[model samples]
Target: MASASSSIIPPPQPPRSSSYSYHVFLSFRGPDTGNRFTNHLYSALDRKGIRTYKDDKKLRIGDVISDELEKAIEESMFAIIVFSPDFATSSWCLDEVCKIIECKNKLGLQMVEVFYGVEPCDVRHQIGTFREAFQKHERKGFHESEKIQRWRDALKQVTAHSGWTSKNHPNL
Candidate 1:
């Protein structure tokens, strides 16, 4: 019998200089609150002299995970998730959330979640419509998948985080 060998690999280092005060990564669902809240949030952040990264304007089908989007997420100092009523409906949004959580853990990046029209408890407990949508996704063929687990983990992490809600503003 042959013995298995393992090798160690060093983790990638984050950028040294923090040039921008806040490098913002905006994540939102398109049909839900993408046009309304996301646009306003992006504009406000830009006006406040904060660097922000957002998706393209044109709505092209199957245009998923471009290099620009990946670079933006990687360079961002913080990620902001605008959680609307239909946020959990899109798999793309869920995937983005997973990536944001990954960055948070690996690079010490910060995160802010805004529950626009939904209650925090709904997200925290994965109850109500969220549970239904998630269940549907699983039934549609996502169950027992690593990506689904990651998405679930990301949602839990975001809900557990201390952030601002549309109804209640935190003291900045």
Candidate 2:
């Protein structure tokens, strides 16, 4: 009797050179503008030959943190933050922003801030709706977290940097 023969196949390897002008890490609040604006931006980036990393997979039942997500952020060349009213309300988003900023300061990662439907001054001063969101979070006993303060500092830093503003941009 002849034994069945199996063919060996070589493991696939990642491309030596990524076919992307920029490796973009998108940061946004899923429930708020995540589905709409974030999707649009991702699509546009893809069209422009820019590789973007987005969290579209569902989280595991008990999965609170993702190593893959962090790795993607670390490997990205640029981080695009979608700043909206609900952005600061998310601790996860804030943490991601902090990591991006840390990479910016330490690893020299470039960042682009998208005000979405808000103004730069609001994010800078932590006033207006952003202030309200922080206030609510504070009332809910999340004000003391280091992440919150880091988020605030990131917002201020982003505002100080040059970036496109949805409210006052000539064209984006």
Best by lDDT: 2
Clashes per candidate (backbone, < 3 Å): 0, 0
Model 2 scores worst on lDDT over the 10 consecutive residues at 1-10
Q: Local distance difference test, per candidate?
A: 0.70, 0.71
For residue 167, what is the lDDT in candidate 1? 69
TM-score of 1: 0.77
RMSD of each: 12.3, 12.5
**Candidate 1 — which residues are off by over 4 angstroms?**
1-22, 57-67, 169-172
- For candidate 2, the per-residue lDDT at 43 reads 73
